[model samples]
Target: MYAIVEIAGQQFKVAKDQRVFVNRLASEEGQEVSFDNVLLIGDGDNVTLGAPAIDGAQVSAKVLKHLKGDKVIVFKKKRRKGYRVKNGHRQSLTEIVIEGITASGAKKAAPKKETKKADAPKAKKATGKADDLKKIEGAGPKAAEAMVNAGLDTFAKVADAKPEELSKILSEASSRLAHIVTETWPKQAKLAAEGKWDELKELQDRLDGGIEK
Candidate 1:
C-alpha cells in the first residue's frame, strides 16, 4: 500500500518503512508525528482519493534525526553602481521513516481545553507607558504603532531586530510605511536604549532620512 501525504507544506509518495527527508519539524528525534493531510491511498487495485484531504485518514512517522542541508551561495551585483553582496544559506531538514498508514477509521485526537480558575476575574488591559519609537529617525507614528503591535514596544527590542525583520514588519503593516528605510533604525534604537542621546544625535545627523549618507 502507498499513500500521498502532505508533510511540511510538501507532498510525497510514501510507503511502509520508507524513509524520507522533509522540512524541519518541531518534533524531537524519536518522536512520532502524524500527518492527516493524506491526498490519496492505494492498495492493490483499489484507491481512495480525498476532495482536499482525507477525513480521519492519517500517515504516521517517527522522526529519525534533524540535520541541515548543503549550503547555497547567493550573489548579487549592480553594474557600474559598485554594489555587490554575497550570502549563503542552508535549510534545516528532518529525516523520518514511515511507520504506518491508516486510510480511515482512525479517531482524531481531541484538543485539550483550558481550565480557567473560578476566582480569577477578567484582566484589564494594560495602559502602561511604552517607549516613544517615533523619536527614532525614519519612524513615524504609523511605523511606531506597527512596531508596537508586532511586540517591539521597547527600544531594546527594536535594537535587537535585524534590518530584514524590520523590513518585513513594515511591509506587512501598510503601503504608506513601506518606503521607510530601516538600515539605521537598529543602530539608532541601540543608542537610544543605552541612553546615549548625544551619540544618537550625531549619528542621525550623518544619516539622510535614515539612510546612511
Candidate 2:
C-alpha cells in the first residue's frame, strides 16, 4: 500500500519503510510522528481519496535525525508571500522513515497523549506558564508570538532550539517576520533559563538586533 500525505507543508507519496527528508519538525530524533493529512491511499486496485485531507487516515513515521540541506545563495523561505534573502543558507531538514499507513481509524490523539504524559510529571503546575520571549533582541512581538505558537513557549525550549529551526518557524509563521535574525536567541534564552539575568543583559547589550557585534 502507498499513501500521499502532506508533511511539513510538502506532500509526498510514501510507503512502509520508505525514507524521506522533510522540513525540520519539532520532534526529537528517534521520536515517532504521525501525519494525519493523508490525501490518498492506494492498495492494489482499490483507492481512497480525501476531499482535502482524509479523515481518520494517517501516516506514521519515525524521525531519524536532523540535518542541513545543500547551501544556496538565494535563501527562499517556504511560505506564501515568502521573500528571499541575499545571503547563503542551508535548509534544515528532518529524516524520517515511514512506518505504516492507516486508511481509517487513524488519529493524532495517541501520540499527543503520550507526549502530554511524558511532560506532565516534571512540569505539573508549570504547564500553563510561558516565558516572555520578547526579551530577546530581534524577537519582536511577531517573532516571539510565532515561536510560542510553534510549541517553543518556554525559555528552555528556545535555549535548546537551533537558529535554523527558529528561522524556519518564523519564516513559516509569516513573511513579515521572516527577516528577524535568530542567531543570538538561543544563547540569550540559555542565560535567561539559567536565571543569569546579569549575563543575559550583558549579552543583549553587546548584540545588535540578535546578531553578535
Candidate 3:
C-alpha cells in the first residue's frame, strides 16, 4: 500500500518502511511524527481519494536524522553596471521513514477557544477613507490590506515608511507578500500624497511592478 501525503508543506508518495528526505521539520531525530493531511491512499486496484484532504486519514513516520543538502550558488549582476552579488545556500532537510498509514481515526486537533469578558465590547474596525495603496506598483489588494491593518492607511504614512519596514509588514501579512520588492513603494507614495500625478506616472512608466528597470 502507498499513500500521498503532505509533510512540512511539501507532498510525497510514501509507503511502509520507505525513507524520504523532506524540508526541515521541527521534530527532533528519533521522534515520531504523524501527518493528518493525507491526499490519497491506494492498495492494489482499490484507491481512495480525498476532497482536498481526507478527514481523519493519517500517515505516521519516525524522524531518522536532520542534515543539510548540497549548496546552491546564487549569483546576480547588472549588465555594465559593475553590480554583482554572489551567495550560496544549503537547504535543511530531515530524513524520515514511514511507519504506518491509517485510513481513518486520526483527527486534527481542535483549536481551543478563548473566552472573552462579558462586558468587553468588540474591537472596532478602522474607519475613514483608506488610501488607494494598490496604486503603488507592487502593492496588491492583500498587501494594501496588510498596510491598512498595520495602521498605514494614508499615502503620507506609506510615504514615511522605510523599505525594511514595508518588507516586515508584508512578511507578516502573508507568504505571497513576502517576496515583494519594497524599494519603490515609499517613493511612489510620496508622489501620490503630494498629488504629483504627472511625476508619479513618469516614474511608474520607468518601473515594472514596483521594481526599477
Local distance difference test, candidate 2: 0.80
- Give me the runs in candidate 3 sitting further than 4 Å from their true place: 114-213
For residue 153, give model 3's deviation from the true position in Å. Answer: 17
Estimated TM-score for each candidate: 0.55, 0.53, 0.56
Clashing residue pairs, candidate 1? none
Report the lDDT tens digits of candidate 1 across residue range 20-85. 988666566999988887999999999999998888899999999977788788899999999999
* lDDT score for residue 77 of model 3: 100
For candidate 1, the TM-score is 0.55
lDDT of 3 by residue, 1-213 (tens): 999987765789999999999866555689998887789999899899999788899999999997778979889999999999986656667899999999989967776345532333221223667778899876889888888877788899899999888887776565446546688889999999999989998898777434555
> Candidate 2 — which residues are off by over 4 angstroms?
75-86, 108-213
Model 1 RMSD in Å is: 11.2
Indicate whether candidate 1 or candidate 3 has the larger TM-score. Answer: 3
Clashes of 3: 0
Task: Score candidate 3 by lDDT.
Answer: 0.80
Worst 10 residues of 3 by lDDT: 116-125
In model 2, the worst 10-residue window by lDDT is: 119-128
- What tens-digit string does per-residue lDDT give for candidate 2 at 1-213? 999988876889999999999876666799998888789999999999899888899899999997778977755565676765565556667899999999999754543355763665533323459888888876888887788877888889999999989987886676455445677889999998999999988887676434566
